[model samples]
Target chain A: MSGLILDFEKPIYELERQIDEMRNFAVTENIGALNEEIQRLEKKLARLRENIYADLTRWQRVQIARHPDRPHTLDYIAGMMTDFVELHGDRAFGDDKAMVAGMAKLDGMPVMVIGHQKGSDTKENLMRNFGMAGPEGYRKALRIVKLAEKFEMPVLAFIDTPGAYPGAGAEERGQADAIARVIYEMGRLTVPIIVTVIGEGGSGGALGIGVGDRVLMMENAWYTTITPEACSTILWKDQEKAAARKTDCAEALRLTAADLLELGVIDGIVEEPLGGAHHDFSAANQALKTAISESFAEITSTPIDTLILERIDKFSNMGVYDVVPADPV
Target chain B: MSWFKKPNSGPKKGDGDRRNIPEGLWIKCDKCDAILFKEDLDRGFRVCSKCGFHFKIGHQKYLSILLDEGSFEERETELRTTDPLQFKEKQNYPDHIKNYQKRSGLTEAVITGKGAIDGRLVSVAIHDPSFIAGSMGSVVGEKIARAIRRSIELRCPLIIISTAGGARMQEGILSLMQMAKTAIWLTRLSEAKLPYISLLTNPTMAGVMASYASLGDFTLAEPGAMIGFTGPRVIEQTIRATLPEGFQTAEFFYERGFVDQVIPRPELKETISRILSYFPDQSMSPESAEEGV
Candidate 1:
C-alpha cells in the first residue's frame, strides 16, 4: 500500500481478480463465449506477466530483491534442494537462528546452502531480526562452509538482508571477529562456490556468504556496500532525505542485478516473471534452476583445485582498474 | 521572578574567588614539559602532540577517530543494566551502572557499529575506558558479538579497538563468560574466512586482552599504547622487582613481535586502508613495497 513498497504479485493478483469477476458475471448472464474468452484472457495474462518481469530497472529490481513473497533459504531447500541436515552451534557459544545453514542436495549432488532469512510476519521478523544476522549467524554459516569443505561439497549461498544487526549482545559475542573469519576462510576455500543475491544484499551482511566461484543475482535483486537508507542518512544527515531518495540511492549504489553484472561484481543475472517472481513462482523457480544448473555444470567440469583457483582469480579482478590520466596536448 | 536575585553570601565587592577563574587546571605532559589545558589535552585524541605521549581516550572519541567520517551508526542503543548478580563489593551494581552511564553517556562500555575506512566497509567495536575503566561486562560482550556477526554478514573486515581494565567485577563470573563467548564467535568468523583486525589502544589488559582481542589476522597498536594480558604492576609485584622499561608499551610489543606495527593516530586510517587494498582480488606479494613492508 505504501508508495515505496512494491507489490511483486500485482499482475497475478489482478488476473485472478478479473477471473473471479468474469465468473460472477457469467453466472448472471447467458453469454456463451464468456467461458472461452476467460480462458484466453487467463493464458494471455500468464504470458504477459512473464514478459513484463523479464527486464526491470535497477530500483524496481531492488524491490524484487527484498520481496517478502520470494523464496527464502527454507523455501529453496524445500523446493529445489533435498536431504538437508543442519549442524548446530560453534561449540563455543549457543546456536544463532538468523543464519540457516546445512548440507543439502542440488540435483542429487551434495552442496552446502547458507543464507539469511527474514520471517513472514511480525513475530517471526522479531525472532529473525528482519534477517539481520548477528555473530552467531555468521558462525553458524561458517560451520556449514567448513563442513562442506571437509565433505567436499560445493557451496551455495543465498544473500538477502539490509545488514547485520547492530545489537549490543551481538558485539559481546564477537560479531566482528566471526565475520572476519568467514571472509578469510572463503577466500581460501578449495571447493566450488555459487552465490546468489536473492534479495536486499546490503554491505557485509551480503558479503558474509557471498564469496563464490559464480556469483549470480536475481533479475529483480540488488547488492550494495551499504543500505540505501544508511547511505542517505550519512550523506544528508536527514532521514527524510534518505527516504525520499531511495531510487537515486539504488542507482548510485549500483545495487541492481544488471548493474552488478556490467560492473563485473556479478557473473550473471537470473530472469524473473514480468511483474516479478511473485507473479509466477513456477517460472521463476525454473529460471533459477536452469541458471544454477548451467553454472554448476560449467564450473564442475574442471578439477576442484582449478575451479577454486579460477574463482579466486575472478574475484581478485573485481573492482580493480588502472587509472590513466589524459595525455596533455 | 526578580531579574537578579540577591547573592546567597550577601553582596560582596569583587567576589575575589580565584577558583572560579578557570585557570591553572593543566596536566603536565610526562614526555614534554608542556602544560596544556585539560580541555585541549582531552581534544587531542588523548595524545600529546608536542611529545607524542599517548594518553587514555574514552571509547566514543576513539571510535570516531578510528572510523571514516559519517560512517558510524551506534548499535544496541537501549539494552542497559539488570543487576544480574546484585554485586556490592566496593559499590552497589545499580549505583555503579548509574554513575558509569552518567559519566560515559553510553548505555554500556562497548560501542559497536558499521563504518568505512578508506572506502573499505568494516564493522567496528570499541571499548570505552571512561565507562568503569572500560570494563568487560555482559553488555560489552553482547555488543562485540553483534558487531562481529554484522561484519560477517556484510562480508566486511571486522575491527575491535580494545582498551579495557580487565573484567567487570560487578558482574563477577558473568563478565568472564564473555571471553569464551567472544572466542567462539571469533572461531566461527575464522571458519567463514573473513579478516579480523584488532587495534590495541592504551591500557588493554586482563580478561579482554587474553580473549578474542588477541586473536586477529593483523594486530596493530597505537604508539605508546599499553597492551598485555597482565598489567606491569602485577608482574612487578609478583616478581618482587622492577620491570623493564616500556614493558607493555606498543613499541615494546612491536619489538617483541607481539604487534605488527606501532602506528600514530594520523596514520592509522591510512594503514588500515592500505591493508584492505592489499587483499583485493589480486594476489600481490605480502611484502609489497606499497604497504611499507
Candidate 2:
C-alpha cells in the first residue's frame, strides 16, 4: 500500500497508524496490555474502513481507481498467469510499451492476455505514456489478437488506461484506425473473450480491447466516456474551471462501478477488498481469477456458430430504450 | 442563439438598402468579413459564396442533399435520451435535451434509417453537430447499431456521415460504451459482406473518429475537415512543440492513407452517388445509375 491517506480515510489511517505503533511497541517491549489495545484498534479500523468504502462518491472512487498501488497489468500477469511468453511488436511498426499482450495459460486454458500497463512512478509513466497506448500498441494488440484467433485461444483484456496516447505521432500513424480495427476484428472472433476493467476505463483506449462476451469492473474502478476533467472543460468551457469542477463532473458522469452496472454498461462488478484491490493483492488476484474462470465457463460452452452472434447481441443490448419491438431477429 | 442577435439593429435610415433587406437576417462569414444574406447562404448549402467556407449542416439537411426524392425512411426515431445519469451542470441534462430538442426539432444527435442514393437503397446515419456537438450517447449508439443491423437485414450498403466532438459528457461512461458498441455492429456489417462508407465532415475528433467513423470499408472525408483522435492544439501543448501546417486536416489524413478521399461539400452528393452506383442493385435499372444518377 502507498500508506498515503485520502481526506475521507484520515480517521481510518490514524487508527491503523496507532495500531501499527502499538504492535511495534508490543513486539519491542514484550507488553501484553498494548497488544490487546492494538487488537481492539485493528477491529475499529476495519469497521471504519468498511463504513467509509461502502459509500464512496464517484470522485473518491476515481482516486482509488488511480491509486499507485492498484495492481498493474504486469503484476496480474506475473501473479495470475502461467507460461506467459510476451510476444512483441505490431510487425508493421515498432513495439509499443503501453500495451503489453502475449500468450498465456489461465487455469489450464490457453488465452491471449492483453492489457494496458501503467507505470508506478514518473520515469516509468513516461516510458509507458501513463498507460495510454499509441497506434503501434493497438496494432501490436491486433497482431496478437489475430494470432490468438489462429490458435483458437480465448482472449482476456485487462483494461486500465487514461486514454489512447494523444501524441501527434500516434495520430499520424492513425490511432483511430488502429483502435477501430482491433474492435472490429475482435468482434468477429469466434473464441470466447472476457474483459476485466481493473482500473480506469477511459474512452476508446479501454474499448480497444473492451469488446467481449462478458465485461467486468473492479469495485473501486471507474469507467467513463471521458475523464471528469475533460467533461468539465467541455461543459464549463474553461480549462482552469475544469480542474475545480471535476468532482461535480465526476458525480454527474455516473462512472463508478455501481453506477455503470446499474446503467447496463458493465456485466459484473468484481469485489475489491475494503481497502481496495491495492491493500490485498492476494484476495484481488483470487477474485479476478475466479471472475475470469466463471466468465469463461459461461461463454466457452456456446457453440462456435453462435458465439460471435452472442457477442454482438451482448453489446447490442446495452443502451437506452429499444425502438424496435422485442421480437427476436 | 447568437445567430438571432440583430447585427444591424441600430436606428435605420430608410434609403440605406432597406428595400426587402429582410431585417435581422444577415450573418458575418467566419472566413470573410462580408455579411451574407441568410436566404442566399442557405440556398448555397450554407457555404460562403465568396470564400468557399463550408458551414456545418444538420443531419436532416444531409439527408435532403444526399438521398433521392421522398426515399428516406428513418428508423428508431423514438429512442430518445433517457438521461440515465440525471447529470446537471449549467443546467440539468433533461433541460439541455429539452432546449436542443426545441431548437433543432430532433431528439438526439444522429438520424439513422434507410434512403436511396441514386436509385440504390443504403442504410444512412447522419450526425448533427448542433445537437450536443454530435456526441455519441447510448441512444445515438443504439440507433447507429440498429442502422447497421438494418443494412444487414436488408442486405444493403451502409453510410454514416460523422460530424462529432466526441462522446456525450452527461451520459458519462455509457456514452463511451457507444464507441465499442458502434464498432461492434460495423464488424457485423463487414462480416455479412455489407460495405460501410464512413463520411467524415468537419471536426470528427476523439471517440467518434476513433471508432466506427474510422473503421469504414471506404472512408471519405470532407475537404479541410479536422479528422483526428485529438485536437491538434491539445497535442501540441502536450508535446510542447509547434505542429506542421495542416497537421490534422482531411488532406493530411489523405496523405497518410487514413482517409480514402476528401470530397468537397458541393461534390459530396455526386461522389456518394457514384460510389453507390459501384454496388448496383440487381433488381432495378438494369445497368445501374452509372455516371450521374
Candidate 3:
C-alpha cells in the first residue's frame, strides 16, 4: 500500500527503487564501485523530485491531494494537538461518522477542531462514506461549533470531503437545509474561525462548514464547486467524451490552492512538504501548525464584534463583476 | 382510493404532442396532457387547471403578480457578469451570457428591487428560469446581497422567489462563495429582526436551495416544484434504483418538514399578503397603513 505511485510520480519512484536495490547489493557483496553509483543515483533522485513537484499541473496536484498516503484530519490533530476529547452526534438524529469534531488543545490553548474523515482503506472508506457527509454530519458540525462559541474557543476546521453525499436518505432528511444553516450560523459565530483545506474541498459540502475569518488551503488541495469529471460530463454531454476531457475541465476550473489565492477566494496557502504532504507527515503537520497559530493569534486579538463583521465582509467581496448602466426602470 | 389505480388514458405528454398544439392560442400542460386556451392559462397564472403544476414564469411576471401595480422600482440593474474565470467549453462564458441575455431579455438570472405588497413597502428579488435555468453566478449573488442590504436600510420585509438549478459552475469557486456571501448578509437581516420570505418556484435545486433559499424565516414553495439538494436523475444514478413517485417535489419537501407551505400560483398574492400582515409594518405611511388594514 505504501508503494502506490501516481502516474506523475512513476519516474521518481523508479529512481528510488533502483537506489534501494543498489544499497542492498553493495551491503551483501561488499562492492565499493556500486556505492559510488548509488550516491550518483541518490543525487539524481533529489533533482527529479524537485523538478516534478515544482511544476505540477492542477490535475497532478489533485491526485496528490487525494493520495491515500496523504495525512487525514485525524492524523493532523494527533500530530499537532495535545489533549483531545472527541465529541459526537447532532443531538437530533443518529451520529454521522463522516464528520469528526471534538474539543482539543493547541499549544496549551483550548480550541475546537472539526474535519471530514476519509478512510485509509476500502473497508474504512465505506464506513466513513468516503468523507461525503450527510445532513446529520453537517448538523453535528453545527452543534459542535456552537459549543465552541459558548466556550469562546477559536475553531480550526479541516476540509477534506468530496461533497455532501448525494443520496436518497440525505435529501429525504433535508441535506440542503442542513448545509445552509451551517453556513448561516458560521457567518455569525462569535469566536474566531480559521479554516484549512487539507484535501478535496468539494462544493457546498466544503463550504457548509468553510466560512471563517481566515480561510486557508494546503498547497496541493483543490477547492471547486464541482469535480472536473462532473464538469466534463455536463459540458460534453457524453460519458466517454467526459472521461477523455476531464483534464481540460480541471484546467478550466482553476481550483488549485494557488489559483484560489490569486483569485482572492482564500486568505493564504499553507505550504506542503517537498514531494507533497504525503511524503513527510511531520513536516506537513509542523507547517500547518505554524500557519494556524499565526492566524489564530491575529484574529483572537481583535474584538469579537469587529471580527464577525470583518468575516462577513471578507466573504461579501469575493466576486468580480461590472456595474453597467441599465435601461430606465 | 384503490391500491392500484388505472393509468389515465390520454395523449402521452412528449415532444410530438407539444408540437401538435398551436403555438399562440393553445398550450399543453406539462404534467397532465390537458390542452387549454393560452388566455385561460395566463388568467390562471400559468398553472395547470387540471393537475396544478406551476409552469415556469419570467421574473417580470412574478414582480407584477406579487407586487402592487406600478410599485416595483427595480434596484441593482447595473450589476453585470464579467466572466471572471474566463471559462470556456464549446463556447466562452461571455458568449453564453450574451446568448441568454438576448433570449431571456434580462441582464441576469435574478432581478432585485424594492416593491410594495398590499401597500406595505418591501424589498423583492425574483429568479427568471429562462436565463441559464436561473443559475446563480457572481452577479446574481451580489445583487441578492445588495437587495438584502436594501431591506435593512428601508426597514422592510424581504421576499425572494427562487428558481435555480444551482450555482453557476462556469464561474467555478467564485460562484460557490456566493452562497456564503448571501447567507452571511442574511444574518445581518436576521440580527435586525426583519422578516425574510423565500418562495421556491419550479426546479429550485442544489447551491441556491442550500443557501439563502433555505435560510428564510418563512419558506414557501410553488406546488409540485422540484426542491432538493440533488436531482432525481443524479440520485437514481448514484443509488442505482428507481425513485418513488413524486420524489423531491415541493409536496415531498412539505411532507418531509423542509418546506413551510406548498402554495399554488393563483393564491400566491393573497397568501403572501396574509403572511406579511402577521409581521409589524413599521414604515407604512398613514394612507398605506389604512389601505393595509
Candidate 4:
C-alpha cells in the first residue's frame, strides 16, 4: 500500500512504484546502469511530490489533515513529552476515548496535555470514535483542565476532531452543553492555555477546547467551520451539481491555516515538513514542542486576571466586519 | 463515532389520539394531522390544542407572552450587522439584510431587552426564526453577548429563547465564531453567580444549539421542538439511513436528559417566573447578598 495516497500524488507514486521494481531487478541482476536509473527516478519522484504539496489549495490541505499516516495525539506525546500519565472518565459518565487527557512533562515543565485522538487504522478509529468526541470526551477534557488549574499548571490542547458525534447517546448526554462548557471554562481559567489545531479542526468539536491565550494551527492543517463535503451539500445542494462546486465550498469556508491567520482567528501557523507532519514524525514533534514553549512563555508572563480578560476579548473581538457602503460592481 | 446508548426513540410523544374538527381558516397540524382553526391556535399560544404540536413563534410573540404587560424595553436596536463579509452568492448579504429587515422590522434575528417576568427584572433575548431562519450572525452573537453582560451588570437573571438552523453561512467563518463569543458571556454570568435560563424552541440546531443556548443553568424547551447540533436532513444524507421517529424533539431531549423540563406554551411564563424566584438576589435585595456568604 502507498499509505493513503491522494489523487494528486498519483504521478509521483507511479514513478516510485517503477523505481522500486527497477531497484529489485538491479540487485538481482547486478547491473550498475539499472541502479543508476533507479536513483535518478527516485530523485525525480521526490521533487514531483514536493512541488505538488508546496502551494496546495484548500481542498488539498483538507486531504492532508486526514492523511492516514499523520501523527496523532499519542504519537506526539511519545515523541516530545515525558512522564505522561493517562487520565480517564468524566466522572458523571463513562470514559470517552475520542478525547484523551493526562498529566505530562514538556522538557520537564509540568503541563496538562489534552487532545482528540483519531486512530491509525479502521479498528483503532472505531475505538477512538474517529476522534468525533461525544459529550463525555469534552467533559473529561474539562475535568483535566480544571485539575491543572487547581495546581496552577499550564494547559496544552491539541484539536483534531472531524466534529462532535451526532448520535443518539451523544445527543442524550448533552453534547452541545458539554462543548459550550469547555469553551466557557477555558476562557476564564486563570492558568495559561495554548491550543493547536493539529489536524481537521471541525466545527464546535474543535472549538470545545480551542480557546487559548494563543491559538495555533499546523501549516498543512485546516480549521473550517464545516467540512467541505458538508458545506457543498448545504450551499450547493445534492447530486452532480454539488460535487462540481465542493472546491468552491472549501474556498468559501476560509478553513486553511493561512486563511485563519488572515482572518485573525488564529495567532500563528507552525511549519510542517515538506509533505506534511506525516512525512517526518519526530521533526514535527520537535517543531510543536518548541512552538508550545515559546507561546507559553509569552502567555504566562501576563497577570492571571489580564490573561483571562484578554483571552475572552480575543475571541469576542474576532468577528467584527464593516458593511461596505456600496456593492462592488 | 456513535458514542451513546440509544436514547428515547419511539414515535412522537404528546401527539396522542386527536379528534377532527370541521375546517374553516383551517391549518393541518403537521405532527398529528388534526385540523386546527387559526383563531383557536392563537389563543393557545400557537400550540395545537388537541395534539400539542407547538407552532413556531417569533420574538415579538415571545416578549409579549413571557414578559409582564408592556414591560419589555428592547435593547441594542441601534446595533446593526456591518455585513462585514460583504458576502454574496445568489444575492449580496447587504441586500439580503435589507430584505429581512423590512420583512421582520427588527435590528437582528434576536430581540434582546430587559423586562419584568412576574414583576422580577430579567434580561431576555427572543429569536425571530423567520428572519433568515434566525441564523446567528455577528450582530446576533454580539447582541446576545452584550445582553448577558447587561444582566451581569444589572445582577439579574437572563433568559434566551433560541430557534435557528445554525450559523449564517453567508458570513463565512465569522458566523461560526459567534458561537464561542456568546458562550464566553455565559461563563461570566456563571462566575458572577447569575442564573441563565435557556429556552430552546422548534428547530434549534447547528452553532446556535451548540453555544449559550445549550449551557443554561436551568435549560428548558417547548414541546415538540427539534433540539440538536446537526439537523436530521444532514444526518440522513451523511449516514444514508432513515432516522427513527421523534428524532430531535423536545420530548425526546426530555427523555434523554438534555432538557430539564418540556413545558407547553401556556405554562412557560409561570415556570420561568418560578425559577427566577430561586435566584438569591431575586428574593432578597442586593445588600442582603453582600451581608452573607
Per-residue lDDT of candidate 4, residues B1-293 (tens digit) = 32221212322112111121212356667678776676677566877778877877777778878998877776666666765544554467788888777665655688887878878888888888757878888888888888898788778899999998888877766777888888887888888999999999987887898888888999899988889987787667656788899888898888877889998889999999899888755422345234321
Ranked candidates, highest DockQ first = 3, 2, 4, 1
The candidates, ranked best first by lDDT, are: 3, 2, 4, 1
- Per-residue lDDT of A1-329 in model 1, one digit per residue for the tens? 12233655467667878988998898788676799989988998877666656545566776666666766667767778789887666666767667888888888988888988877666877787888887788888888888889988889898888776655445345454566457556656778888888777765556767777888888877676556665455445666776887566555555677666765668899987766666577787778878898998887779986775575456434432122243121
Candidate 1 lDDT (Cα, whole model)?
0.68
Q: What lDDT is reached at residue A143 by model 2?
A: 87
Candidate 2 backbone collisions, by pair: none
lDDT of predicted model 4: 0.81
Error of 4 at B203 (Å): 2.1
Q: Which stretches in model 4 have alpha-carbon errors above 4 Å?
A: A15-50, A323-329, B1-24, B82-99, B234-243, B280-293
Give the CAPRI rating of model 1. incorrect
lDDT of 4 by residue, A1-329 (tens): 12888888788778888988888888889888886787788788878987898879888888889998898888888888899999999999889999999999988989998999999989899999999999999999999999999999899999998888877667767887788889888878888999999998988898888988988899988886778777777666666777887777777667889988888889889999887898888889889888988898787679999998898898889786544344231
Top model by DockQ, which number?
Answer: 3
Each model's RMSD to truth, in Å? 17.6, 5.6, 5.1, 7.4
Model 4 DockQ class: acceptable
Model 2 per-residue lDDT tens digits across residues A64-125: 88988889998889888899999888998898999999988887778898899998887898
CAPRI-style quality class for the chain A–B interface of candidate 3? medium
Give, for candidate 2 chain A, the lowest lDDT window spanning 10 residues.
A320-329
TM-score of each predicted structure versus truth: 0.57, 0.90, 0.94, 0.87
lDDT of each: 0.68, 0.82, 0.87, 0.81
**What lDDT tens digits, residue by residue, belong to model 3 across residues A1-329?**
45468998899988998999999999899898898899899999999999999999988988888898888999999999989999989999878889999988998999998899998888888999999999999999999999999999988899998889999999999999999999999999999999999999999999998999999999999999998888898899988999898888998899999999988999888999987898888999999999998898787779999999899889999998998776532
lDDT (10s digit) by residue, model 2, range B1-293: 34443434523222111121234577665556567887887676767788876666777668778888787776776676786788877679889887777655677888887878877878889887767778788888988888888788777888999988888777777777788788888877877888889999888988899888998888999877889998887799778999998899999999998988988778888988787777747222322223112
